[model samples]
Target: MIIPAPPAPSTPWPLPRIKLHIEDLDHEGAAIFQGAVNARDALHLAVQASYRWLYTVDNPPPKVTQILLILRSMPGVAHTIGTGRDGMEKEIHFSLEYIVHSKARATAEIMGVLVHETVHCYQHNGKNTCPGGLIEGIADYVRLREGYGPPHWKRRGEGAQWDAGYETTGYFLAWIEDTYGAGTVSKLNHCMKNKSYHKRHFKDLTKCSVKKLWNAYCCLLKDDDGAKVLEILSARDDDD
Candidate 1:
C-alpha cells in the first residue's frame, strides 16, 4: 500500500514531496526495514544528503516535485528513476531481499543505499552524457561522506582508475576538496548542470590538466604504506 510520507524536518534546501510503498507489509524484510530506521526521517536525510554534499544555497538542486520510494522483493539493492519527462517526479526502488540479507547491519546499510539512490534523484548527468562510472562515483561519494561506508570496503583509494567509480572516485574527490578547498567538488557538479561532460571541467576549476591531477593524486598514495587512502587519489590508465 502506498502511504503518504510525513513532512521533512525543516531545512533551507529544496525538498521534494516524499511517498512510501511497501509491497508486503507482513514480509520479514519489511519488518526489519521498519525497525532499522524511521521511514520518513531516513528518506528526508537521503534527500538532504544529496544537497548537503552536491549543492549550496545560491546554486540549489534541480526542481523535484515528488519522490516515491517503493520497497519490494528484488534482486539488487536499490535504484532511482525519474518518472517525469521534465525530471520532476522520481521513484526509488529499494529491494526487500537485499534488506533481509543485511539484517545484522540493517540501519547503516539501509541508510547507505537510500543516500546512494537519492543522489540519482537530484544529480545532474551532464545531459545524460556523463560517464556511467562517474555518475555512480558521485552517488557513492555522497554515501561515503555521510559516514555510511560499509565496513567491508577498503579505506584505500588504490588499484583502480580515477573513474573506476565507487569509493575510488569518491575518495579522490574528497582529496580534491581537502587539498584544493571546500566546494571544489560542488563547482565541478555545477559545471555539469548546463554543459556536456568534458575533462576540461577539471582544468577549469583546478588550473591543471586531468592527467597531471590524476598522476599527482596517485603519487601521494605510494607514500602511505597502503594504510590511508581517503586522503589520496587513484591512477588513471587511459589505455584501458
Candidate 2:
C-alpha cells in the first residue's frame, strides 16, 4: 500500500534545487544532524527565511539555481560560497565538529546556521563592495527573524560601530525596520543591488546617516525608548 504526503504550503518566492553531501555519514555530528532535523525541510526553511527577510515580491531576489549543503568534519560553524560564474549555485559547508560540540542545542543551532548561510546564498553584496560586517549582519538578521536566535544573543545593540555584525547589526537593522516602517531593510538591500556600497545609502533610505543611525540606535538601547530614537535620527548631521 502506498500513500502520498500532502503538498507543502506554497510561497510567493521561488525555491532552488537542494542537494546534500555528507563527507562522513558515520560521524557523530552526522548522527546528531540526522536525528535533529530533516535536511530537506531545514534547507527549504532557510531559503524561505532569506527570501522573506531580504526581498519583496515585486523586486525579485537573485536567481539561485541550486544550493548544495555539504556536511563534513571541519572547524568553526558554516559558510556559504558561490561556485558558479553567475553566482547562482551555492555551497554551504557546515562543520560536523561544531555540530557535535553543540549537541544539546543541535536543532536550534543547526537551523540558525542554515538560515545565516542561506541568506549569504541570496543576499546581495553591493557588487562586492558591501562591508563584511553588514553582510554577516544581514545573514544573522534573517536568522534572527526566523526565531532561531540562540538565548545567548543580545537583543540590544553593542560595540563601537553599527556594523559590529552578527546580532549587533542585525538588531540595528531590525530597529530601523521597526522605526522607519516595514520593508525598510528590503529597500536597503535593493539599493545595493548592482551598485557599490556607501554610507550615503543609509541616509537615502532612512533620511539619516549611518553614523547618526548608529548613535540613535545605541541611545535607544540604553533608554529602551524608540520614540526618543527618532528625535535623534531627525537631527541633521554635519559630520556625515
Candidate 3:
C-alpha cells in the first residue's frame, strides 16, 4: 500500500523569536561563521526545515517561544538546551572551532548543524524515555531530508547497531518511510510525543518489530546493488 503524504500547511507556522550570541568575535571560527551565512537567515531556515519535515499543519507541536544561537569555543559541533521557567526557550550552543575546521564547507555544515540541533528543540522525546540514539537519529533524519547531509556520509549494512544514531539510523528510518509509506517517520515521531517510548512503537507504526525491520533492511542492502540502495536513499517529498 502506498503511504499517503503528510498534510501540507496552507500557511507557514509562526516562527520563534531568534537571537544570536557570539562569545568571542576574535576567534577565527567566529570570523568564518560570520563570513559564511547570516545568523538570522540560517537559524530561520534551519527551524523551517525542521518544521517542514517533522510536522504538518494539523498536528504541530507546541511553539518554541525563543531560540538563542550561541557560538562559542567548544569540544563538539553543537548541542541544544532548554531555558526559561517553563522550558519554552532554547539555546543552541555551537562550537566556533568546529566551524573554522569545516571552513571549506562552512555554509552547508553550519546550516546542517543548525537543522540537526533545531530538531531537538521541537521533537517529542517520549516523555524523556526515548533512547538518545533514536533522538539523534530523528534529528539527523531531518537534516538528511532537508538535503544538507555532508558528502562523507555513506550507507553501510554492518558495523554498528541500527539505532547507532546519526546518518546510520537516519538512513534506516528513511528506508522504512519509503517501503512502508511516506508519513512513516512522521508517525513514529508523533507516537513518542505524549507517552514513554517503547520498542513496541515501531511495531505499532510499521506492524513489525524494530529488530525484524532492521534485519529486513540489512538484507535489502546485501541483496541489492549500490544503485538500487541509492535510489531508495535519494527518495524525498517533492513538496518539501
Clashes of each: 0, 0, 0
Q: Write the per-residue lDDT of candidate 3 for residues 104-140, one digit (tens) a residue.
A: 9999999999999999999999999999989999998
Model 2, 1-240: lDDT tens per residue? 112212323456668999999999999999999999999999998887777777776767888999999999877898888988887999999999999988999999999999999999988888999999999888887777778878888855545678878988898897888778777888888989989999898888877888888888888778967678778877878654
TM-score of each: 0.86, 0.91, 0.89
| Overall lDDT per candidate, in order of appearance | 0.80, 0.84, 0.84
Query: What's the true lDDT of residue 14 in model 1?
Result: 58
What's the lDDT for candidate 2? 0.84
lDDT of 1 by residue, 32-90 (tens): 99999998899898898887778887778888899999999889888888887787899
Give stretches of model 1 more than 4 Å off: 1-11, 155-158, 225-240
Candidate scoring better on lDDT of 1 and 2: 2
Candidate 3 residue 121 C-alpha distance from true site, Å: 0.6
Stretches of model 2 off by over 4 angstroms after superposition: 1-11, 156-159, 225-228
Could you tell which candidate, 1 or 2, scores higher by TM-score?
2
Q: What is the lDDT of residue 103 in candidate 2?
A: 97
